[model samples]
Target: MRSTVSGYSALSKAHKFSAAGLVTVAGAAALTFALVPQAQAADVQSAGVKTVSLSAQEFGVTQDGELAKAADDAAGQAQVKAKAAVKAEVKAKADAADRERASRSEARKPMKPAAKPAAKPAPAKPAAKAAAAPVKKAYADNLDGWISESLDILRAKGIPASYDGIKRNIMRESTGNPQAINDWDVNAVNGVPSKGLLQIIDPTFKAYHVEGTSWNIYDPVANITASCNYAADKYGSMDNVNSAY
Candidate 1:
């Protein structure tokens, strides 16, 4: 009975030691889990801060106020250049129209019937050239005379309008009246009424006014010159236009 009791006591001691060992192992495992998470969390937070700082620096450099203003100024300069280019294109077109009119004037010269079919063709060309030279005519007050005078001026200025074209449009629009006005039309309602022989609106007259013509819309020469200039801008030349345009 004594030996059996002794054996039982030893067995109890062994079991207690085993349980203690297991508890130590469990505590170590718990500590490792807790410490590892803290270290990982610190690293993650540091990386997050660095990312945020870099983003802020990038925004500061790219979207700063001074840089933004510089970008806007460049855009404005580009716009100005574009507008100037458009103006240059318009000027080039007008110049081409003038050259075309001069060519046509040359072509319209009357030939001297080949100098009675006996003279050289070269002399005939010279005769045609002399005929093509503008003849100085006394300006008259009548519509016919006025149109003839206006054609002379157009020829001098290299404008491409013809007497027939101008006269036809004037007769249709204002019946040869220099002081004509459309007081009931859309232009009139807008306070920019069509005035003068060619039915020119006020804005059109102002924008296309010629250098030597009178400022008054009722002035015959002024109205015709301005109308021709406007036509040149709109349709290449007055000779190219017909009808209600």
Candidate 2:
């Protein structure tokens, strides 16, 4: 019976040792689970921090690039505007200079003379009229008219004589009788007879007959002109004769 009791005590001790080993293995497994979870959490937090920093750097780079591009564009636009302004100003100045030069050139030129008005044409003259016929002058029908007519003929023929001298000579020769004849005188002894107011012979009357007078020897105007012509030739004039010439 004692041997059976010892065997039972040994079996109890072995069961107690197995139970302690099991408890230790359980405690190690629980500790490993808690430490692995804490380590995984720390690694996740670090990866997140790195990811956030990289994202912030990329955003900054993009923003800087945009700002630089904007600045370059603004600068380019400013340059273009400035150049356009400068070109416009230069053109304006050139235009002003051209205008000023033209003004000065115009001022230096001489003033033009005023234009003269066109001359008016002269008026046409009227046509000349034809000459009219001369009117005959009327004289009295008397001895005075005959004497005046002879005197007018003598003046026309350029013969010079006086009315008083002719009348005095006519009164002495024929007593103012145009038809008287001196047939008994020295002129009558010849073939030609003296006749008319001045007693002129036919040959003497023909030789001294004035133009525009009657050819008849007894014609009063014809005889007077012919005798006066003969007297003017023989003597200085009929006015100097006081008797038969």
Candidate 3:
């Protein structure tokens, strides 16, 4: 029986040791699993805390994008400003040109004055008249005898020679003879036709012949009256009576 107890204790101890060893192994495996999880968490935290650094290529690309955006915005603003400035300048030039044109037009305009009438000249005055001359004595005395016979015949004719100068011219022409003839005539042969008293020829007799004288060339009253009428007609107012007959 003692041998049997000793074998049972020895088996019991062996089994207990074996169970303790199994529990230790399982605890060690569990502890390793937990430590692995903790190590992985610490590695993740360390990676998150590490500082990141960029390469030249990555930094240039980032700066280039920002610069391109800035250039685009500046270009847009510049275009707006250029358009506004161009419009303002064009408007200003047009206004200035219009003002200049208006100024030139005003300067070219014509000025006007009041209308005036033309004047007329005054008229000039007239000049004065001249005086008359006197008669002489020598010419009156030489003209006396012919004056009486011209008056006698003119009295019979009822038409007297009014002036003394006219009668003197008649006596000088025919000596108061009714049948007196000029010597240019002959009696019978080679006789040129002779004139009557006062030496009146065929032309004078025909020009002054009276209707009541009966064609007689020697009729004293008819001859004398005709001679007086001829003298008055030849001279104006009998003033040049001697030269007229």
State model 1's lDDT.
Answer: 0.72
lDDT score for candidate 2 against the true structure: 0.72
How do these models rank on TM-score, best leading? 2, 1, 3
Extract clashing residue pairs from model 1.
Answer: none
Instruction: Please give the TM-score that candidate 1 achieves against the real structure.
Output: 0.43
TM-score versus the correct structure, for each prediction: 0.43, 0.50, 0.29
lDDT of 1 by residue, 1-245 (tens): 11123223111344334434433543322112111233344453344344444544554665577688998999999999999999999999999999999999989998656545565556444444445665656888978887777777777888888888888889988999987899998888999889989999888899888787788888888888889888988998777777756
In candidate 2, position 129 carries an lDDT of: 72
Query: Which candidate comes out best when scored by TM-score?
Result: 2
**Model 3: residues >4 Å from true position, as ranges?**
1-160, 163-166, 185-194, 237-239
Candidate 3, lDDT over the whole model: 0.52
Name the candidate, 1 or 3, with the larger lDDT value. Answer: 1
Candidate with the larger lDDT of 2 and 3: 2
Candidate 2 on 1-245: residue-level lDDT in tens? 11123223111344334434433543322122111233344453344334444555565677689999999999999999999999999999999999999999999999999898898888887877777776766767656776777888888887777799888888888888888988787778876777887788888899999998999888788888888888888886788788877
Candidate 2 pairs with clashing backbones: none
For candidate 2, report its TM-score.
0.50
Residues forming the 10-long window of minimal summed lDDT in candidate 3:
27-36
Per-residue lDDT value at 121 in model 3: 57
Task: Indicate the residue-level lDDT of 46 in model 1.
Answer: 49
